[model samples]
Target: MKQDHRVVRRTAAALAAGALAAGALAGCSSKNQVPSIGYGVDAVIASYNGGSTLGANSGAAAVFSRVLTGFFYTGPDGQPVADTDSGTAKEVPGDAQTIQYRLSPEGVYSDGVQTSCDDLVLVWAAHSGRFTKAGPGGPVPLFDAASTDGYRDIERVDCQPGSKDATVVFRPGKHYSAWKTLFNAAELMPAHVIAAQVKIPNVVTPVQTGDQPTLERIADFWNNGWKLAPGKVDLTLLPSSGPYRIDSFGDKDGLVLVKNEKWWGDQPRTPRIVVWDGHSDLKSKVSDKSVGVLDVGAGSLGDVNLGGFRRQNLPGRGVEQLVLGTGGVFGSADARRAFALCVPRQALFDKFGHPDYNVKLGLGAGPLNSRTVQQDSVYYQAISGAGDKYKGGDATASQAAASSGMQNQTVRVGYLEPDEQHTAMVAAIGDACRAAGITVIDAGAPDFTASQLTDGKVDAILGGTAGMPGPSGSLNATDAIASLRTGAGLNFGRFGNGRYDAIADQLAAEDNSGTVLNLLTEQENLLWSEMPSIPLFAAPRTIGFGDGMENGVAGPTKEGAGWNMDRWVLKR
Candidate 1:
């Protein structure tokens, strides 16, 4: 039942020296006169929310994170810092879960309307999923959000209209490790613009103004009205509070941003920034010295011929995953484990140019990156030893199959066809599993989305999860585990088990940081034991900055290559 596949290794040697240096380091600085910075983005941003900007693509995330200021900012090393420059948040006295926020009086949208508590309330509602059950669809969220961790626990919001102050109280006994990271600047979209377009009846009201019907109407416009296209670009409609605003969107799939005159913070170093899409030829871009900056995320270093360009190792915030569909060929734990045991995880990572790209073999010791978990932590030690169950390669896989009668079993695995590296990795997986009597069928698709696998279109999927770092510089397992829970929005594998859910619930209730880490390790152990999904490798963030681009840094900051973008300047 072994299927034929080609396993080719890209030149991973290009990133060996650069990855060793580690940490966030700036590229070569310059004082040359350059008109603007032309950087490469990962996605063609069309919508301002929902399935567009906040989705899996990091390009839209980069733009939103920079232009919109949040209550908190994540440093290059993934630590959360309260952003007093734009706003201030303080815990209310006598209330363990209540916090008060005050915005800068100078903060205003591009249209001159002051950004106030109303905006924060709107963002909190959208991300909290509080109004989801109010709709007719029965527990369906009005607006799709990237993460709903801290917001979902919100009990009440007291906002002073026309003022910049608001108080938010969450339900008691709830624990959120990423409380500060939830409402970061990148997530605070323009509320006034959305309200105006939606045309809600009563304009000025308190934080809880929108009812079920009114909120649905507003959500409809908020999700679709902000979408931009060539010849359909409405410059006036896209009002923003960030340091920059959308100037123009070209028909050729290019986006341009210019300085925001209403910006409340310090002026950015570069006045203009342009982003292009689908430009995979980094070698040509570097050789021509045309592209000033490039986000080489999970790209092959062997193909990159760096001459004068600087390779900056971005933070490893992505994990390659192999998800098994319980309803399909991997209906039983034994079947799933047999195939996982045969997978050449190292080989698959090698093809992605691991080590060179600063890619780690797995989450290392826990659900988060190795850097976040202490070496002596119980969770770290558990994950370190958890790999023993399936470490024998072909022999281990063959034995697992023999025990479960899964030998020569056929399993269909799907991945995005456009992702050359993923395709190569899938091929490597197929080659490795063949000797164990498992056949991995290639089910490639164009631009694979979460809906595809979740809807049962594919039996198994080659997927990934982005790292969400906490205040202590470690990765939080809450969002990752929450998303994969049965019926969760991002749960594409349809993995459901009461035992797993109970463990996850227990993990969520633990208040102490140490307890959370131990629980995270337990969750990971349960996941590995069940074999619903196997962690492949952490995708390394890599970017090549051309000459004249000063203050360009690459690290494992959750913000991607744009972490220090405000300070980035094209030497003029």
Candidate 2:
């Protein structure tokens, strides 16, 4: 069913000479003050202080995450670096799993330090694994375990030292496969730059008194390092294998992201990206100007009807999920199926600003919906014998639940209610469930904590998988599955079908499908069959930029380092 939603987001446009008029040209010689040329979309609201900042705000995290090395790099024309996601990019079987990587002989950070397998080892450890001050307990997962030479995960380190192809390998526990399926989007960091500092991609004030932890120390010498904070935007560019390098950045003024002059591969279509700081309004300036700065803003034009602009029709990357938990507080399969049928997907769409905001409330991330468990999944397909009775609310068929040994209980639902966005959606889904005869007992707040799960009030929870570059596995199908049955996971709903879990386990250990996807169509098919968590919608990435600011500023509806901010230009 197609729905036209009115666009409610405010918007504006920058009219400049036809795109062909602006091309790449270098200018130098900064006087006392840096003469600047700017663009239209640079105004992003700044709230919260650093690490404790809004965790739900991916808009900020996406930009902050880019301050250092991007997880994976695409080519000048948006192509993934050749073989970047090769064998080394396999899944692990256990949460204690780790994957090693070998750098290409040619890999180098912007600072000229050659990238290596060690960097991957230490960096991944820093983000989620142990090795830093924080031990590897909790939900933090690392890519490489003990990143010593000839390590478990790393195959080779490429040129400089540990650089080499097929040198790195993943060393996840037996269940590592399940974990890998859930967390493939995390970018590996370079530890060389972060060695002496207490943290990799160190945030917060550098330790002035205590001796900073060295690479060796982090590797073996007590793993003494600083705690990482998401608060600070360390513009300090160490280096990276990705296309663009960080030229310079200020505390709050924003970072100037220029193309890597030393970039070894084909030059990027939009070479330089100058990210502006903070969300501000310079309306008149944008309309009357032609300068060297490609703008970064969040405010729309005062005169332009933002309503029309939003309706202009665009794509997005907002991910939504329906999770089922073993809260045991909920009903059995029969009851769950009844609840699923009652979910008002249509109303949920209507409330979130359809077409514009709600866009396509289609379930899950994969083609069939939820990426982790798909329709064709061996697990799902095997479970398929359960039949359509699970999806549609046919009384006669539901009666079969009694005959088939499916339970009859109403599952309680816990959902994320961190802010306005979460509240509305949760309410809508609740209404849907209410119509279906299932009572959606409000656990209160959309930002549901893990403790909520153990409390067992949550039969189902609403959440989303981290956005993957493309439609692939369940963010980490095996891990997502493991999370359901064994290890703790974002899958607050402890949903596990025996057949599906087994297939996911096998698929995780071996990428027989020839893709890095966690949630493939098979998984989606599985979700459709199981309806553990009803698939809700595909998340959209909103990117908006000045129309004529740069020659090739072509990007998504919401502008940022993620898209065409690099090739943008200023009119003279």
Poorest stretch of ten by lDDT in candidate 2: 3-12
- Local accuracy of candidate 1 as per-residue lDDT tens digits, 1-572: 21100000011122333442211234434244466777663443555552222332323455555666777655444446566656787766554477888888888888898888887777777666666655465677777665565677777667765578988788876655456765665667677776777665322352376576777776676556777565578877777777788788774535777788888777777888776543334445456665677664555323566555566643354455676777667778888788878887655554553544342333332223222233334566554456545442557788888787678787777764445566677778778888888887778664454455556777677644521111012255333565556555545676787777666666655667677666666666677777777766555555666655556655343355555565566663
Name the top TM-score candidate: 1
Candidate 2 lDDT over 154-258, as tens digits, reads 322222324443222344344333322211122344555555453543211111112234433443412212112223434442354445665555433444455
Question: Model 2, residue 519: what's the lDDT?
Answer: 35
Candidate 2: C-alpha lDDT: 0.36
Q: Can you tell me which runs of candidate 1 are displaced by over 4 Å?
A: 1-31, 43-46, 50-59, 133-138, 201-210, 228-232, 251-253, 278-288, 313-315, 349-353, 357-378, 399-418, 442-446, 466-474, 477-479, 497-514
Per-prediction CA RMSD (Å): 8.2, 11.1
Q: What is the TM-score of each predicted model, taking all chains together?
A: 0.82, 0.53
Model 1 Cα shift for residue 91 (angstroms): 2.1
